[model samples]
Target: MKKHIFLFAIVCITQFIYSQNDNIPEKKTQKGFGKIDFLSIKMPETTIPNESNMGFTGIHYNLMMNDWSYAGLGIYGAVTGERGGFFTLGINAGIKKYFTNNFYLDTGFHFGGGGGKSAPDGGGAFILPHFNLGYNFKDLSINSGWSYVNFFDGGEIKGHQLNVGLEIPLDFSYADYDVAENDYSFDGLQKSNWNVNSKKSSLMLHLNNLEIKGDDTNKNVQNFGRATIRLAGFEIASYLSKNWFTFVKFDGAYDGIKAGYMDVFLGGGYHLPFNKNRTNILAKFGVGAGGGGGVDSQGGFLIYPDISIEQKIFDAFFISVNKGYVMSPNSHFYTSSYGLGLKYYVERNGIISDENSFSEGIFKGIEVITKQDLYFNAKRDGEPTEDMHQISVQINFDLNKNLYIAGQTSFANFGNAGAYAEGIVGLGMQTNPFINDKTSFFAQVLGGAAGGGDISTGEGFIVKPSAGFNYQLNNTLSLRTAAGYVKAKGGDLSSPFINLGIKYNLSFLKMN
Candidate 1:
């Protein structure tokens, strides 16, 4: 397995190099739009053993690759029945056929990794395939479909059901990375239809210490006396105004509890600048659902409210300190937290009040990729090691010609441990195009949190080093493959993994 992994890394580099040559394939800058789907599905049976009949709430963002097809990300959570905290998130792609301007048939499938609330998610793998008929209106589309939900590992949950959805239009802007790199004018960006308030955005990393409050009477786990839970995660925020912004955060446990404790939050905030625009005060609030690790938050509804102070430490970089409280109103968990963070501004292509003004993400290249991972000899503390499958998304930002920074999140989709997840960030280096611009290769090292699904990821701290090949499909898309090893800190988890992915190149720039 180790030798194969090493060979795979070499092949990845070879493919990536060949894919980037000037002679391979060329395409012009293109414009595309996407849609967001708010949907629901209900199983056909009752709760528990009859885990059928449970209703799930879902959301998907599909980016149009063309008029009739899209690739996107989706998430679903149990809203009705006894499994309130059961959820899954992963990658999806779909195709639509239009019989008329207003009528269409939609088909798609979602592969996600997440399980909670003692739900029978054998190792956290979930699959849903749907077929629907719809009528499109000027503003939105409505559809109903037949869906098949399968948790394909050691899980016993399977169902056929009817699903309904609402589709709303979303718009964004992009340009070819290679084109923009050679001739950036920052004009014509206004020509694309954008829907956001501004192009300004920030990526933040945070380390937090939480003091557990409340009793275990309402939670899935019991008897904790003022424990301290340490967590780390990342946040991505986009400004709606100069002082207002919306954000999403994901955090995982590293201490004070068994590994696998995690949460994801969405909210908005306001920033007040002072000290000659170098210092600011910010207030934020987030609400979301979470449960896992032995410290189960039954019914899984949580809220976080906080205030912080930020100071600009360098150009495009800021440092912050915050104090906050966390509570699960519907469950039995509460905590007070103190945190420190580092934030970097990134320019995005979006709607701006002043078209001529620049946002922070000026001259950069970005890559967003969706991946499917297969891990060999995956293990649980007391069980035999087995193979596991996971779904993940990785975002990369070019720091220089041969180097890039990357962040990734992954969830187990087909393994013995359901509700298993991971989040990591690190740096990578790529070789120049080889094999006639058809392929290239690269390698990276990442460190972050992992735990859940009974995996022995001690304290949820881990490091992964990987190497891969990139096969350029076109100017803006590529096929990627990587092989890596994951080793947990102070834990008993070690595995070799391979992943296959689709990559999309994004350039947040304009040409003359």
Candidate 2:
């Protein structure tokens, strides 16, 4: 396994170096310009004994001048051991070039590999033949290709391999032969422009089949043979300038059980274009339906409506709010939920398209408090009481122009007076997942801490890692709900908590 991983790394680095050649347009060529590239490779799926998986890491450097390509020695290695004590080593060399803007070919021979003998015997040699197809617009480039590996004396390990990968150049530089003044700039402007033009579409098709078996009294059920089908979906949109443009999208899901259900959404919105680029507000509305029990059955219609607001603060974070309503009767048996959510985006995109923005700095306001309490008290030899209240607050930070981090803190004050504050804090990485719009998703993790009080004499911390899917509804209001496990430390009793809540976002206050 180690040997195989090492060889794979060498191939990856070689490819990266070849791809980074200076493919710039120029006028004169008294002295041809060259380019240097570095590549990294990752193994697909391979498991070793007592080890999670066997993989290799490689770094290759290549230089390209005119049509002649030269690559030096590459180094790679793999780690394989039982829990601990693992080692690896590898080496390789190769030469490659592009025949066209989209097609390239290469041939490489790799040797020298090693792995842990006690861990697992994973070693092999190979002669690799590679072919690649690539498309470049501005700064964005997409490449996919396959390679054939001929193993030298390895058991059942020589065959053609097919894999796909993507490359996102964090910084790009090009040489200009037309002018003798300076090389190209790495300001990321060209790369950003390329990203705007080379946008691809996403196609999504979902089919669900469900089975239920239980009595109406308990409502307890089991699921079986729930077939899920996902088809390709596509969309294409680009930025006009900074944060303003028009976009159209088509997304829907279908299920083939219990009268089935289907939903389709198609709508678009643009940035306000006035409050610098740090603040973006958008609205989307679409129509969808669900039905199954044959055509005679009454098919229900649904309205997909949402609004989103994003604001940046300081220079290292941001905050956003979303609210929306979904009216559907097929699934969840004629149920409707209105939701509001708040989030923070951190480590921004390093661009400040706007400076004098009103939504700058951190938006810190008096925390909003909402509570629901349940009490049970007894008067006798002993007194017992229990109550719970939910409290929530929204926080926003200005990470940069294109990035920000948002979060929500919610706690359940058990009202035991002595019971420690028990609640959950949700932290999410926010990004605009739509084209020319501010629609985004929050990848979050929830956790909390508890202290021993009069009610329960114990102390400990609680951590729950959870993931939630959120859609921005509109400005001022947002909807959010999440499910996560609850663990108690210092004590023995623990239970998971399912949380749901709505928030109202208020911003741009005058400071006294």
TM-score of each: 0.82, 0.26
Candidate 2 local lDDT, 1-512, one digit each (tens)? 99999999999987654543233122221212112122222222335333333233233323232353443222222212111111111223444556777455544444332222122222222344445555544454444456554323231224455433343322212212111122222222233321112211111111112232223432112121322311111222233444443332222112222111222233444545346556767565644332121111122334555565666664423354545544442332222222222222221112132332222212122112122222222011123433323333334322332233333322222332211223234345544436434244444554433322222312323455544433445533345555554444444324444444443333211101
Stretches of candidate 1 off by over 4 Å are 1-55, 78-85, 96-105, 131-146, 162-166, 179-198, 215-222, 350-362, 510-512
Which predicted model would earn the best lDDT? 1
What lDDT would each prediction earn against the true structure?
A: 0.73, 0.32
C-alpha displacement of 6 in model 2, angstroms?
68
